[model samples]
Target: MTALPQERRIVTAIPGPKSQELQARRTAAVAQGVGSVLPVFTARAGGGIIEDVDGNRLIDFGSGIAVTSVGASAEAVVRRAAAQLADFTHTCFMVTPYEGYVEVAEALAELTPGDHAKKSALFNSGAEAVENAVKVARAHTKRQAVVVFDHGYHGRTNLTMALTSKNMPYKHGFGPFAPEVYRVPVAYGYRWPTGPQNAGPEAAAQAIDQITKQVGPDNVAAIIIEPLLGEGGFIEPAKGFLPAIRDFAAANGIVFVADEIQSGFCRTGQWFACEDEGIVPDLITTAKGIAGGLPLAAVTGRAEIMDAAHAGGLGGTYGGNPVACAGALGAIETMRDLDLNARAKAIEVTMKARLTAMAEKFEVIGDVRGRGAMIAIELVKDRTTKEPAPEATAALAKACHQEGLLVLTCGTYGNVLRFLPPLVIGEDLLNEGLDIIEQAFARI
Candidate 1:
């Protein structure tokens, strides 16, 4: 049965009473460095709603940037984590291996798309998983050059920053990035090098040509990409792009790596977005929703590639924390039982239908595209020109949040409104949120 949202109880202003006080205190105490996305502080979250510090419940559409797929405060996840907590905490998988760690690894090796014998290495964050994948690729291929696609986000670390294409937010101050990292253009259909009509395998072929000419394929170790480019405006590569890239990597002896941090764990209506294209990468890096809300990441790949890393070269002090490992075990089990892949597809269907209708109603909405639960709507000034409407997107997001529906914005130009609702979200709530989006756009 689909559940309707209770109400939109603003209580006070946008920040409310308690949030303002906390914000001032936070400004005084915490590093004035990082900032908050939403001003209202979260006191509790359940199902698809976030209860703020002032007791106002807001419908959640971000899903913690696609990390909490099963929904916040999930009963099954809480129970499993509590049970594991009672037993013990840490043993350091490097020094003394635990059954839970191995169990999680086994689950990953089995669940990750591929029929081949695979191995998994655990880490604590998406960045770590990406870094380790690079190490493994270098070790296996005995090459130093690694190629990454434009608009792909790996992580914030030095190596990842170099691998990442964004500049202002991620790699602004951090200079002198890691060496031997290369970047190529991704097949962005909306505004491709050649017009959208010609943005198919031909765009990818041009990129491959540039790499072969400039970088020289003989020196490349690996080519990394997100199956569905996440931070790069949720752009889905053209039909033939992925397959062509895969074939090129295989033919050139360059290990193909899939950065599934954002698109993994059924976020794309499949275990990994790569599965949709039937391209099994040599290495797949995952994190985000892998361990429910806990911090955990992994690199699962061909046994030969994974085994190339030296025994001690791939571990962190708290790499596979026991609690996190237990969380991952429970999360994977929950995904299997709940059939989250199907749920993602269901969410995609709901979103595509309503958003497409909304697009027809609004000229600001230029494009609507995504794989599954991971979806985004690109805002533009005009349908003919496709000029990004960043201000309009900001206005729409602000209006939705004021109306008690939380949505996130992304893109190089900041004109895209992305929806990453929990797969377990109720249909009524989802529709209600879509209604709010419609109302916001109507006001525009």
Candidate 2:
């Protein structure tokens, strides 16, 4: 089979002849509720690029929202998955335990931070992993309250929806959310109430104090946060803040949860984003990009805490499917063999240099921040006022899309453009994507 870039061929309009034909059939034959990110339809993808039904091959900077970090159609993942399929598909780990499932859990135990004894439970999606993490925390602490940060995104399930910060799109009509969920302010230095450049320990301290007084430390179960907020603009916390929160959770007998669903698997140049702060969480929830695009989410934590869940309460029908486990095993191996951590770091190096130059050249480029392959640029009206320029963001994204680059925009205000290129992306392709970004910004 030909690998991802089979050869760039944009023979027709962006959506092309075939895609337009499919779109008509899609609206009539497919569910009316089906949604799409772009007007073009994908026919194939691989190694940091996606080919549309129209045959227009575009450099993929989004990576399916940071899911295919090892690259789509990864050699090992494809081979291992096919090998497993030849054996059997489903046995249901809960019904009849499988070696692959146990093996994946064992690998997670060894890979997750902390040399202390640990255990892991696998689920089918990031939301399930997040829900299970809460179950573990609640069972371990015997508490009722769960704390989530402002502008932080956990998942889409009912409980996670309550845990999420955004109101529209995620929680607009979804109401009567799970009870006992509390919202707290995250340390977003850029948009902190204190001031853009002034966010620091003081803001973190203030949020901590409020939670302590209102929620009561004794009643709180877990304080879950994204080490680097993913869906909430990819905003990394200010220094001293994560360490401080760690100390607080420890002192209060509350479990600290790090939601690394979008930042794990060497995506952020580290095994886990929390590693950046030298802080180990009590429970870590991960998914997206794990298992090389296969469905697998995990909750890895201190053994005692993970074991607190009732024996029958921690499983799912499709959790740890054998084929998915095989894919995960291969994905992890591929990541290590490729030395993707070093590659992610190299991407950061190049992006910083080029994007910094763009920042100096463009007045609308307000702030650029992120780690490794997960970098982003915040658009603004002016450097002095710092008003979010969402309009410019839309224009820039449209320009990039029209020019054969796949980019994604995020942030609470929808003004941040994020880059999540696969770790296996070629340096030439990576720079080409960045060049497209520069050109897009220049046009804007």
Candidate 3:
């Protein structure tokens, strides 16, 4: 049944004639605001390869931005989704409740970082889940203000745009954002003002201090953060930072939320990245890898807090669509049956080993950090100055593309090359992708 071959083969240029023709049509049809990493249109994808319309198969290094962690067309995911489609695609959970939605809620309760009583509300996207998490937190605590960290990416909705730190791309002209969202610094070790050693404790202390003085902790509903940063770069807060902030939130009676949209579902060698720091959030927003390649998201949280939202307030017209729920159930089974967590850890070991060696030879690599399959290297112009090298990063990505490898570049400074390979990706394919990266860096 497997039709797509998992090998890198270039029949033409990176974006061949067919892809270029499609790109021209796309430019006219699709909105310019909606961006894409590569212009090559995918015709088929499986395992570690994405086959473009021009018959070029490129090794995947970015798992659709951590959405397809299992794989592009995972058997379980496709089977369940297809089966569900045969019966029904959408009846709307709000209009007619289904068992699949409840099943997914039960799975989330069992899998997310806490043994404590938990509840979940499904949504259509990571942004919706985040917005709802904040809604529930505000409802529970009766507070309006929310605290967020710098270099943290929550979502693109109005509220999330306010919470996000990057201004140019995500929040350029769209302003007059939702009020009461405050920003604090994160323990970004590489770019920390002071240094890496003191980044953890110092950042936590400063965050708490700022909240108390500037925002007034008693009036704050939640302090939200990403256990592992995504679009703002795959920066993991320095050690002890998350726990410290978690304790502060607990002491102040403010809900703590972990935006695990990009880092959860076995992406970080664990079910959730919050587990990495042993921090159990009051509410955790999840999506991306939750439903394999399908669209589904949820806000899993403490029972009392989640239940505080009114019965009628949380339901959405298409949230937790039955087909998507089925896909999520299948994705969960795939994650467990194949032991993707251990595979992710293995990927971390391999990627870190290769990336660290590359850092030694290439001065452009200023820092290499991340856990499990979510690894990245910060690009810099000068080793001593640590100036961001966005230009070099772009050139390196283009070079890799030409050599039949799909890569992604990110970071607030646009100078980090992130890797999020599918858990089912073959080790041989992984190394081949890395080889392409090494050669590209050499040429760049």
> Tens-digit lDDT track for model 3 on 385-409?
9999999999999999899898999
Structural similarity to truth (TM-score) of each candidate: 0.97, 0.97, 0.99
lDDT of 2 by residue, 1-444 (tens): 236653345567777778888989899888865576567888778887788877799888998899899988898999999999999999899888889988988988887888889899999999999999999999989998999888999888899999999886788787879999988777888777676455658767877998989999999999998999988898999877888888999999999999999999899898888999898998898888789899988999999999998889889899889999999998899889998888899999999899999999999998889999999999999887889999999899888888888889888899999999989888888888888899887777
Spell out the clash pairs found in candidate 3: none
Residue 214, candidate 2: alpha-carbon lDDT: 92
lDDT of 2 at 227: 95
RMSD of each: 1.8, 1.5, 0.9
Instruction: Give the RMSD in angstroms, all C-alphas superposed, for model 2.
Output: 1.5
Q: How accurate is candidate 2 locally (lDDT)?
A: 0.87
Give the runs in model 2 whose Cα sits over 4 Å from its true position. Answer: 6-9, 31-34, 193-198
The sequence of per-residue lDDT tens digits that candidate 1 reaches over residues 1-444 is 123244455676777889889988898899865766678998887667877999888888998989989776666667777887888777788899888889988888888888898999999999999999999999998989999887888899999999999896889988999999988888899888567777767778887998899899989998999989888789898878988999999999999999999999999999999998798999999999988898899999999889998889889888888888888877787788889999999999999999999989888889999988999999999888889998998999999988888999888888999999988888888899999999999997
Which residue pairs show collisions in model 1?
Answer: none
lDDT minimum window of 10 residues, candidate 3 = 1-10
Q: Ranking under lDDT, best-scoring first?
A: 3, 2, 1
Candidate 1 stretches greater than 4 Å from native: 1-9
Best by TM-score: 3
Q: Residue 211, candidate 1: how far off, in angstroms?
A: 1.4
